[model samples]
Target: MKLFAVIGDPIVHSKSPRMHNNALQVLMKNAVYTRYHLKDNAKLKEIVNFFNGVNITIPFKEEAFKIADFKDKSVVDIGCANTLLNKNNKIYAYNTDYLGFLKAIDNFCNIKNALILGAGGTARALAFALKIKNIQVTISNRSSNRLKHLSDYECCLYSNLNLHKKFDLVINTTSAGLHDTDLPCNEIILKNIFSNARYAFDVIYGKNTPFLNLAKKYNLKTKDGLDMLLWQGVFAFELFLDCKKTKEIFKAMEIALKLP
Candidate 1:
C-alpha cells in the first residue's frame, strides 16, 4: 500500500481524503489518503520522504515550491505549488491550483478585471492563472508582507481598495470563513466591491460562507472552491499515477466530490 495525504494548518475541515479515497477505490489503486495538521511549514521537508505524494494547501504552497528538488514550469512560473510527487527518493513539485482555478472559472464570461483578497500561496496561484488570460488583476491583502512576492500584479493593502472602482470578478482568497462565521473583509468593503462585480468566488469550499452568502444578497453569480479541489485532486492523482491518463479517473473523482 502507498500513503498520500494533504498537509496544512487547520486541516480538520478538509474533504480531500474523502474526495480522494473514493476515487482510489474506483481505480483500485492500493493507496490510502488522509490529512495531516502541519503547524510548521518547515517540517514538510523532513516528512514527505515517507509518503508517495502530498497535496499542499494554504500557507505552505510557496514553501512547497521552495523545498522541491525538481519543479514543473507551473511551479516555476507561480513560485507556488499545491502538488508534490516523490520518485526515486527525489521530490517533484507542480502547481495544479492554477489549472484547477482556470477550469473552475472556465464558464465565467467577460471577466476582464479581477480583485483577489489575500496574499498567500493560493492567492499567488490564482493571480498567475488570471494573468495568463491577459486579464488585469489587483491583489488586496490585509498586510503588505506576502504581497511583495506577488509584485508582478497590482498589489495593495485592504485599506487602500478603491471604493468606487469595479472589477468583473471578485475573489475571496482568505481563510477567514473556512472554520468560522467571519467574513473575509469588512462587510462594507465586500458590499462596495461585490456590488460592482459580476462574479463572486470564495476559495473556501463545503459551506455557504459569509462571503458567498453576502454575494448572494447582491445577486452576484457565485461559486465555492469545491470544483477547484476536485480538479486539482484529479491532476495530482494523475501525477501520482505518473500520467496514466484516463477519462474514467475524472468521472470517478467527479462522483466522489459530490458526496456530502
Candidate 2:
C-alpha cells in the first residue's frame, strides 16, 4: 500500500489520519495515513523519500521547505510548506495552510485588517497570504526575534499591543492552547481585541479554547481550526491521489470528522 503521514513534534493529537484515511477508503485508493511524532529534522528529510506523500506541521514546516528538492511558489515566498509529495524519488513541497485558512473564512468578504498571533512558519504563510488579498496584516509575537522575519508588515511585541485598536479579523496561529488552557496573550487583551473584532479564529481544534471562549463573550463570530484542517487535508488528498477532491471524497471526509 502507498504510505502517507503527517510529521510534527507534538503530533499525537492530530486528526489527519482519521480524515485522510476515510477519504482514501471512500475513493478505494490503496493507501494508508498515519501520524509521526517527529524528533529530528534531518530524519524527516530522509524518511519522506519512502512515502508517497507527507503532511507537515508546526516547527517543521519551514525546515521541510528547506530540504525539499522542489517547492511551490507560495512555499518559496512564505518560506514554509505543509505538504510534500515524492515522485520518481524527488520531493516536492507545497503549502495548503493558507489555502485552507482562506477557504475557512470565505464568508467574510470585507476583511480589511487582520491580527495574527505567533511568529512561526504558519504565521508567515498566513501573513503573506493575507497581504496578497489586499488585506492589511499585523503580526504579534511575544518575542522580537521571530517578529523580525515579517518586517515588511506591521509587527508588534505582545507587551506593546494597543488594546483600543480594532481589527476586522483576529487569528491565533500559535499552539498556546493546543495542549493546555493558556491564552495566546493576556486574557484582558484578547477580550479587548475581540470586542472590536468582527471575527476570531484559533488554530487549535477538538476543544473550545480559552481564546475562542473570550471571543464568544464579546459575541464575535468564532471558529476553531476544524474547517481549516479539513479543507487542507482535502487539498493534500488531491496531491496524494493525483486527482480532484470529488464530491464523494469531500463528503466522506466530512463524515469521518464527526466519528471517533
Candidate 3:
C-alpha cells in the first residue's frame, strides 16, 4: 500500500487521518493515511523519504517548501507548502492552503482591505491569496522580524495596527486560540481593528475560538477554519490520487468528519 501522512508538532489533535482515510476507502485506493508527530523541522528529510506523499501543518510548511525538489506556482509565491508528492524519487511541493482560503471566503463580502494576524506559512498563503483577488492586505505580528520575510505586503507590529484605517476583513491565522482562550492580539487592539471590519475569519476549526467570539460580539460575520480545512484536504486528496473525481471524494471526507 502507498503511504500518506500529515507531519507536524502537536499533531495529536489533527483530524486529517480520518478525513483522508475515508476518501481512500470510498475510492478503493490502496493507501493508508496516518500522522507523524515531529517536534521540529530537523527530521523533515528523513520523514519525507519514508512517505510517498505527505501533508504539512503548522511550523513545517516553510521547511517543506525548502526541502522540495520542485514547487508549484502557489508554493513559489507563498514561500511555503502544505502538500507534497514524491514522484520519480523527487519531492514536489504545492500550497493548497491558498486555494482553500479563496474558496472559504468566496462571495462572503466585498473585502477591499484585509488584515492578516500572524506571519507564519499560513499567513503567507492567505496574504498571497488576498493579493491575487485585488484585496489590499496588511499583516500584523507581535514582532517586526517575522514580517520582514513577507515584505511584499504592508506589515506592522501588533502595537502599531492602523486603527484609523478601516479594514473590510480581518483574519487570524495564528494558533493562539486553538488550545486556549487566548486571542491572537490584545483585546484592545482587536476592538479597534474590528471597529470597522465587516467580517472575521479564524483559521482554527472545530471550536468557537476566542477570536471568532470577539468578532461575534462586535456583530461581525465570523467563520472558523472548518471549511478551509475541508477544501484544503480535498485539494490535497486530488494530488495524492492524481484523479479528478473530487466531488465524490469531498462528499466522503465530509461524512467522515461529521461522524462520531
| Candidate with maximal lDDT | 3
C-alpha RMSD (angstroms) for model 1: 1.5
Which of 2 and 3 is the better model by TM-score?
3
Q: What number of backbone clashes does candidate 2 have, counting pairs of residues 3 or more apart or in separate chains?
A: 0
- Per-residue lDDT of 93 in model 1: 96
**What's the TM-score of each model vs. the native?**
0.95, 0.96, 0.98
Per-residue lDDT of candidate 3, residues 1-260 (tens digit)? 99999999889999999999999999999999999999869889789889999999988999999999999988998999999999999999999998989988986777899999999999999999999999999999999888989989999999998788999999999988976679998999999888888999999999999999989988999898888998999999999889779899889889999999
Q: Which residue pairs clash in candidate 2?
A: none
Per-residue lDDT for 1-260 in model 1, tens only? 98999998878878889878887898888999999888887799877777899998876888899889999987998898899889898999999888888989988998999999998888888999999999999999998888888879999988899989989899989888765679877889889998889898898887899999999999999999988888888888888876565477677878877776
Stretches off by above 4 angstroms in model 3 are none
Which residue pairs come into collision in candidate 3? Answer: none
Model 1 spans > 4 angstroms off: 243-246
What TM-score does prediction 2 earn?
A: 0.96
Measured by TM-score, how close is model 3 to the native structure?
0.98
If the candidates were sorted by their lDDT against the true structure, best first, what order would they fall in?
A: 3, 2, 1
Q: What are the C-alpha RMSDs, in order, of all predicted structures?
A: 1.5, 1.3, 0.9
**Better candidate by lDDT, 2 or 3:** 3
Query: Each candidate's lDDT (Cα)?
Result: 0.87, 0.88, 0.92
